[model samples]
Target: MTTELTDAELLDAFHRQIRLSGREDEPAPGIVRDTDGPVARRYPQEPGTSYCMIESPRGLGDDPDHWIRRQVDFFTGRGEEVEWKTYSYDEPADLTERLARAGFVAEDREALLLGEVEGLIHDVELPPGVQLRQVDSDHDLGRVDELMRTIWGPGRDDGALTREMRADPEALDVVVVEESPEGPVLCAAWLRYSPGTDFASMWGGSTLPQWRRKGLYRATVAYRAQLARDRGFRFMRLDTTPDSRPILTRLGLRHVADTTPYVLDARRGA
Candidate 1:
């Protein structure tokens, strides 16, 4: 006889794995909150850019529309524009529609993928002179920021990134792969851990156009996976674009559900 795992069981198992590794403690770039009420937390990306993660109001007689409107009011009162990320499992059905009615626009859907760190870790070879290092100092953090701007295209201020990295050294574990001979090239970063969940998220994995198709990206991912495993984390999770879907699939991550963001630009009326 074979034991079978239900979807909920699989999700819970993955969560436990990430929590044990302590990677969930990785510091986010902005303020994080775990409070009472419908709004779980707010992540401020920059001066005017913010996002909210709501507690799924599956029970407790909570009204999704009411809770969402409260969140909008919370951010707008502070003069911050808000983006609300909703997962497929979110309850109080038609939450997205409610957000739209409240002036929040629907964004493209992306996969909320989960996988075991054990499955993702693999020995991969890097090109000659390309080295992977864990960032530790202010200078390393600055370099990581520069690399991120180069790969992802610039917008947000780097000052916020610097402040977050300095405030909580343990909150972030930035891994970089620098190419020799000219300058540092191709960099990636991951939130080693998440608070209250067993999931370490991969973020800011960008490669310069010149470095495309090389194994640098894969190596960076593997390095992070190994780090998670070393810390005893069981699961790794990420929200990815279509470009990264194939690469993640090769690493054994499975698509668990879709995540969509609804945005309310409070600035429009301001």
Candidate 2:
């Protein structure tokens, strides 16, 4: 029987799984902080860009607006541009308006999905001659990098990609499927584990144009979900654009909410 679940139930289950997987430890020390009120603090992926996380302020003791201003000043003081990810279910409290007032540009929102690892990792048929492989060495890394650039466009510096790859080998797995006549046409990667969470996040699901709708993407999803299940992850999470939403929904991932990243260009008005 199919094990479909409600969005809330799936999200709760997914969160529980994340706790069990121990993947939540990936964030740095100051990357996640608690503010005086319903607001929390978060850091960026690197020093150059300012990225922050704001959690639900339900029942928190302080003013959310005041806390947000504090967060803005905290990152702005560092002479860096700031980005904040806000979820659909989050109490608006004029947060987006406040952000706009502070010169933050709002970007498109993406769907936040959560599902059980097993729900995604089912048996799948692969296209004939398409071979799946795990990347391990420098050569493999280079190949993965090349595939990323080829499928997604160029301009990624080698140093940055290498640094990212090195920092979280366990968390990041680059998997690819190669087809003979078309060459290697499918490429994707996932964050296999989160330190304190039972969640594994899938990223970089880029497929070449000629290979679209060929079942390659679904197979890759199953492959990674199996890997995550084997690693004991309970939940699988991904941010999806409209193009991929149908695929994920078919895979049994329920939409938790939508998320948007708002960025402020410090150089423009500083």
Candidate 3:
């Protein structure tokens, strides 16, 4: 069993390489690491996101103000949303300041956690009545989406989800909890595999208030981690909300860094 990466190694490898790796889903054109910043570029079709800009790094274009507008204009010109994935350890420490000055709003802060799947790969036991299964049909998709919608509320779109599920059902494995295999879904979560990197990222790990602490979420994590391991991924990563920090930490995932997403509306800027 492989051990997880240290903070420094994870940051360096993840930002410089794996973060830009094609998950084998979309074209390589979607992600570009330019002199200004690493961007997940999806013009007209989707919003573009920027990541990891070295502040005041000598050489390629160091004018922060001008460079900031250039980035803002690139997206605003396309009427796309701008998300800057900022880390606490990022250099030019004022990168967040610059982002805020550029009119980007900061989203929730989360601790990035990484773990090897070795110890967590066992079959996790949910309460006797609960069972878990991989979502395989539109009916399952709808049920899982509805469960998430109820927990997360309105404003979140299932369009991207639907498209992803249709495009590559295997890469994004969504697992749901139900009373029976075909019963109403009580909770749901997903595991996304990135073949280019040895890491799998966990998303939508939520449960209904009624379903809390019955080990459902943990089971979901175990199931997904084992799935990733079975598929050959060496590590699992997730941005843990403060509420989820304790549970994941106890499970042995190391806290690497704090990540805050800064968003700027291109439409508003235009």
Q: Model 2 over residues 31-59: C-alpha lDDT tens digits?
A: 44444455544555455543454444342
Clashing pairs in 1: 17-234, 18-198, 19-198, 23-192, 23-193, 24-193, 24-194, 26-171, 27-171
Model 3, 136-175: lDDT tens per residue? Answer: 6788888777777788785335544666777777678989
Candidate 3 displacement at residue 236 in angstroms: 0.7
Candidate 3 displacement at residue 165 in angstroms? 2.1
Question: Please, what is the TM-score per model?
Answer: 0.82, 0.78, 0.82
**Tens-digit lDDT track of model 1 for 150-173:** 766675556455676677766567
Q: What lDDT would each prediction earn against the true structure? A: 0.67, 0.66, 0.70
What lDDT does model 2 reach? 0.66
Q: Pick by lDDT: which candidate is best?
A: 3
The TM-score of candidate 3 is 0.82
What TM-score should be assigned to candidate 2? 0.78
Q: Where does candidate 3 clash, by residue pair?
A: none
lDDT of model 1 at residue 145? 73
